[model samples]
Target chain A: MYLAKIYVTYKPSILDPQGVVIKSALERLDYQGIESVTQGKYFQVQLSGADEAAVAKEVEAFVEALLINHNTETYTYDLTEI
Target chain B: MYLAKIYVTYKPSILDPQGVVIKSALERLDYQGIESVTQGKYFQVQLSGADEAAVAKEVEAFVEALLINHNTETYTYDLTEI
Candidate 1:
């Protein structure tokens, strides 16, 4: 088995209202100087019977096919042996 | 100015109920074989007059001080010149 860690975040040019809410929450809690907040998804996938390079390719394709909307979000991944 | 991207996540062993909710959501959206979902926070901070290494140290300290609950969460960062 291998561990595939993926991070998905909105494009820099996009407006993120949820991020805004979180930023305000942090500020209210006295976390000063926090200029912005961005909400994103982190996923840890367990792979079976796949090599690292192949898995990376497949995962990227998978995201492009179904997981992420490439128009609005971008994703990156780190694959590690388990 | 520098951009400090921070990711705060729960310890692996902890029970992630919100993650579970998201997992169910994905499944309902036809995302198959998603074993689990883990929720986390992502923040993009604009720093003033702090070098990469110094900003890293201070940000780590800031997370320890206010952002994360060390007992339940762990954090990491990537600093980039912007």
Candidate 2:
């Protein structure tokens, strides 16, 4: 099986309330010098295939088609054999 | 400055509806051979510190204190100079 480690985050133009909340939470917790916090979704997908190049292409297409909403978010992922 | 690439995923015991939905969506799109989907939060934290070891220690403490809830999710992070 192949494991895809995906990281998806909001575009710079988009407002991320979750990130904002996390920033404030850090401030409240006395974690000084936190320059910034940008948050997104991370996923681990297990694919039942063996062909490396073919799987990478399919995964990219899959990401572009369903995993990312280009209107607000951007995503990047890596596939590794496991 | 240092950049901490953090990934926080739900505990295996927790129910992940979002992942379930994504799997269904992928299946609907005919992306066959997807064994499973698991989702979590990813963050890139910019910290205003120079010392690598001290920064890593602080980042760990920061993650434990505010970035992760010991109740339902687990987190792992990497600190890189940036």
Candidate 3:
């Protein structure tokens, strides 16, 4: 088995309103020195596979096909044998 | 400056409906070798601080205070100089 830790985040060019709101909230709550915050999705996927390469390919395919909005987001993953 | 990469995940005892939905979607799409899926939150936070230790302390504080539900969620973070 293999475990893929995937992160899907907004493209750098895109503005993240949710992040801005969180930052503002922190400020309001008296948190200091907070420059900025970017929020994203994180997934841990377990797969039954024979090898790392094969599992990685499957993860990539599924991530590109279903996990992210191509226009505004991008994804990265790390696959580890389990 | 420091960059804190934080992840907030539901405790193992909590049911993740979103992850189950995603797994079902993938199965419907005919992706094979499926096992399980767990989803969580990721954050990239830029903080102004004198050193890593101090910034890490701040990150922990804010994460506990605002970013997660202590009863159902837990968080981890990596702090790096930027």
Model 2, range A16-60, lDDT digits (tens) per residue? 888889889998889878998999989888998889888888888
lDDT of 3 by residue, A23-81 (tens): 99999999889999999999999999898887888999999999999999998888888
iRMSD values, candidates in order: 3.7, 1.0, 0.9
| Alpha-carbon runs more than 4 Å astray in model 3 | none
What is the C-alpha lDDT profile of model 3 across B1-82, one tens digit per residue?
A: 8899998889999999999999999999999988999999999999998877778888888999899999999888888888
Q: List the residue pairs that clash in candidate 3.
A: none
What are the chain A TM-scores of the candidates, in order?
Answer: 0.89, 0.89, 0.95
Model 2 clash pairs are none
What pairs collide in candidate 1? none
TM-score of each: 0.65, 0.92, 0.96
lDDT for position A68 in model 1: 77
TM-score winner between candidates 2 and 3: 3
**What DockQ, between 0 and 1, does each candidate earn?**
0.31, 0.87, 0.87
Better of 1 and 2 by lDDT: 2
User: Can you write out model 1's per-residue Cα lDDT over A1-82, one digit (the tens) per residue?
Assistant: 5676778889989887877876676677665456656777766666554466776775676567655788899888788877
- Superposed on the true chain A, the predicted chain A of model 1 yields a TM-score of 0.89
* Highest lDDT scorer: 3
Sort the candidates on TM-score, descending order.
3, 2, 1
Model 1 whole-model lDDT (C-alpha atoms): 0.71
